[model samples]
Target chain A: MSGKSRRDFLKSTALIGAGVTGLTTTAKAGPQNILSEDRMGVLVDTTVCVGCRNCEWACKDAHNLPAGNLEDYEDRKVLDTKRRPGTDALTVVNEYSHGKNSSLPIDVKVQCMHCDHPACVSACIVGAFTKHENGTVTWDTDMCIGCRYCMAACPFQVPAFEYDKALNPMIMKCDFCFDRTKEGKLPACVEICPVEALTYGKRSDLIKIARDRIKRNPDKYVDHILGETEVGGTSWMYLASKDFAELEFPKLGKNPAPGVSESIQHGIFAYFVPPISLYALLGGIMWITKRRKELDEEVK
Target chain B: MKKFLALILVLVFTIGINAQQSPGKDHSKLNLSCKTCHSCDVPTKSDPCLVICPREKITTVYQKPEQTPELITINQLSDRYGPVYFSHKIHAQMSIMSGGCENCHHHNTSGPILKCNSCHETSRKREDVSIPDLKGAYHRQCMDCHREWSHETGCNSCHTLKKDLKDTKNESLQKKYSGKDHPVIIEPTKLVYETKSDKGKLVTFYHDDHTKKFGLNCTSCHKQESCTKCHDVNNTDKSKNQKVVTKKTFEDQHSNCISCHSKTENCSKCHGEKTLEPFDHGKKTGWALNKHHINLSCAKCHGSKLPYNKLDNKCLSCHKGWNAENFKHSITGLQLDEMHSELSCEDCHTDGNFGIKPSCDGCHDDYSFPKQKPGKLVK
Candidate 1:
């Protein structure tokens, strides 16, 4: 290659790199290609919940899923076990015994947190998961490879896969009653929560309302808010009477599960520097080998 | 002179002897006392100074606190033999109406009011004689009348009984101090709700004003009878049942509460007036909260906060029930408990509400977002 042409190429590459750096910097919290405007979400109030499993039942009904315990349903034996929402169930209410009359018993509802910076969204090779403008993590089933990467990526342990379906299988999780939310209605779980344990409203408004409730009844709830810091803040927020950890919510590291992996991948593959350096070193080795081969041939 | 000196020395010696023996005795008496006092020192003679005066003698009774016998309760006795708490106040109240404690008191023929131990000794020769040692005496006297007064022989017969013994000791002491003492507390008779009324017509109970606001004693309405007398559902007709079913009676009793409370009258109280539409419980007086709270089960959230509907449903209010740590997430895990699973989203996101948004910048001082690639702009 000509030296003038090579210099021009290097100059163009530097310009391209600078442009990429500027664009990437602007993308954080800025107007970008948001997948959809309507983001699905949920609101949980620890104070009002009875742990009756009515919302869990409603989710099952809406999804046409089977009951948790059909045999001893009337006896309510299933409640004896603490469970997360599985492939069959999208919502599960677990009972937390605060103490033996030392404190009040707290019941927590578990479901997909539907994070703003979804680990599942970043983990997907097929780009099935994407963030919507309204703060929902939506799935594009057409592009899903059923690799189960989304399952491992979710900080909430949501998204159960249909192992029973051999062909064209799908991942199941609370879609935040997306269909219902789009119609300007609260999710079925929110509608069915008898005690106003679950409320529905705009994400911004709901946060304010929850704050007001906590301010008014400071003695009734713990100070920590669940999901606010989880996976870069999930759209679904929760107020727990007990600490979030007591309810089994994970205390994630400063870097969200996906952010850590993304950083590692970026650090290695961000630019062509590492690979180009390796190629140069390999070419040098080959030249030495060629020199030795020529010297051996001349001696022969 | 010799005779006078000898007489004087003898007199001084006698006086010295008298002074040493009985310092406080009259000297005139001592002059007469040598022969008088020496006469007792002789065989078979009682000394006048050491004479036993029957009038100055005294006898004291030793009583145990348990056996002190002021108006002991069956519970006080029950602590010894599993509690069968009989209301002494109630028994005494009834006995007072029947003239006095004399109705139950077994008086000795000599006219001194016989002590309970006088009849009910440690052990009885026969059932008739077994009036009850101090324990049985109190229990029998109180329980016999209580049985006839209330007539329910269950645990409610006595063990559940309560009494005001505050003034019992003073009243008993006053009786001993003067004959003009009364054990009875005179109260003006007010119209009380009698669960055992002859008519099955649900008693018009003014429980809200009396019990809810005034904090009247539960026994005021329940009275001596079990709550079952009015509430028993199985016994629809008060007269015709072979055996009185107080449990069934309560079912009928609840109807009375429902009548005044309009919400309990129909399903619409909870399900909405227009069956097709939702119930606006939030707007109603009977309904303190909305369907969400009601569906979650009021008892669960307000389990311990019951009857008082103004309970705070804040996470901290209930979280203290689990553990108390100001501004820390240490109960179970990172997630909210099941009870708080349905809380509002804004609760955590905002700056004010104990929201979970800890500034990542607070800990990750060196953290930064990666820059964008060329042409991969957000806008």
Candidate 2:
């Protein structure tokens, strides 16, 4: 290709990168991305949970899903098999044998951790997911294009897709009971817990409560609070008697899940500097090489 | 008028000081160190500096099971279900073998038994999440043991759905448990355990002898027994059911006996080829228990400490208080006549050896005991 044509191509690419960078800088200032200090969170004390699946029933009922008789959930046989949150059930509780007491099994309610910096928010091509100021990561059904990138992006492997549906399949996950909380109500799971194992409060307050519980009952709970610093902190945290790994919690680093990808993508387009510089260097090299070839031909 | 105002101010100051000094609940009677409840050395009325929820350290006011109410209708926070009919007396009685009142009424001070709502908040949504709400507290206390023994976490196990209740008043339900008491626990007389010990296979435990004869309290051995130990709902036929022998550490396996029996003692002391008889003073120690000693508990002579110290066979060894003036001859089935009663006990008894038969040869010739008695038989 001619050097002149190559220079034109490089100029167009640089202009496009600058335009995209400008658009992203504007999007970052939106109200939906704010992380408020008083954002609500839930502290799940797994030691107190009694493996009653009432929370499962309550979740479906509150979400307007087809929840059968509450008594049906009392069949503990379902707990024998490990389960994940699916399109049908947004949240599930699993029982693990207690490390200290066999009779008292540890029941952990699994759902979206509602991370402070959600990967889904960053991964969504259409900007469908929003990390609200209140610590809930909610998705806009109308804006969602049925892309499964969110399912892959979630650190918890949450956000199940309706693969069975042929038309208008949607991503489903725990929304932290956004609608209920907007009306000044507790999340369905926390409200329905008979033992109040799930405590809901401000994110800052919940962390304090979680710390106090661990301090008071050192023997009853392991020192670590899962999701406190995991994936750059999650709205929902856990207190277990033993290590969280045994409970099937995904081991994750303290860094936010989207931190690496966001930084690289943003850095490459920031003020269009990197793209422009690379194009200028390539053009200079092409010009020199073409001049040297011409000079050799003249000598021959 | 100025002097009168000064007098009123003085009266108010004294009253304030009295109130500050006297906390409503008296801690003087409680056998607990100040550090148990208070974190600081000198806790003032304004800032008590009390330890927050010192649950393990606080002593519970234990009441006899019979003195407690037979049935309690827990109606607070009953929305989806009717009030639970809790058998308070039965639970209190069962708790004796476990942790007693402290198991449920944890964090109780020396004062009157505080209601559950005192510490546990009524609403689930509260400022402090350190302590569970009333609903959580009540359910945790019940389900901890109920789920263990019954293996059922169904709401129906403890509650009747509000819709299912025929009588909202629950008059019949109250009558069902009003005067009801837990049936008397019939303790086994003996238990023969087949052990894996090579020295001896059979280990006999005399339950009655430990409780009645040895004077051991039920709590001494059954301190932390689980509810599943006795109420095995899964085991329909107790006779046919084989106990799942859990692998316990050597110390845990012998904990109940090791408290009384020395750990250094020989294995054959408990493990034997056949079921050992209930502890017999004469057979085990060669000193026969007589009419007076037979009715007395073993602790009466051996002191309450276990592995009872052996006593030498001497009348004065145990009866140090007894002397010629204080000693009653009639109580020994013999009422000495005027002549014999006047003589000192040593004149006939010889060195106060009550275990040996008394001889008349020390006082008079041809007056042999049993043939010609010095005193008449009381009976």
Worst 10 residues of 1 chain B by lDDT: B58-67
Per-candidate interface DockQ score: 0.00, 0.43
Q: Point out where model 2 deviates above 4 Å.
A: A1-27, A31-34, A263-300, B1-60, B191-204, B236-258, B262-268, B271-278, B305-307, B321-379
- In angstroms, the error of model 1 at A264 is 1.5
Model 2: per-residue Cα lDDT over B318-356, one tens digit each = 888887788888988889998888888888777787767
For model 1, residues A148-240, the per-residue Cα lDDT tens digits are 999987877798898999999998888777776668665777765534566555555556667777787797778766766666677788997
| Candidate 2 clashing pairs, residues 3+ apart or interchain | none
Q: Candidate 1, residues B1-379: lDDT per residue as tens digits?
A: 9999999999999999967755363544443323323334442324444433233332112111122233433343333134442233334443333533455554422123344555454431122321223444554454333333343223333443234234354455445433222344333222223344343322322334444333444444433443233433343654331222244454564543443344335433322212222223456444355333444543456563424356443445655543322333322224444433443433333343332332224334554323311112221
Error of 1 at B311 (Å): 44
Docking class of 1: incorrect
lDDT of 2 by residue, A1-300 (tens): 666697799899999999899889887766663578888899998988888899999999999999999989889899999999999999999989875556677889999999988999999999999898899999999999998899989999999999999999999999999999999888998988888889999889888888988998897889999989999999999999999999999999999999978999999999999999999999999999999999999999
- Where does candidate 1 stray beyond 4 Å? A1-40, A67-75, A100-104, A278-300, B1-379
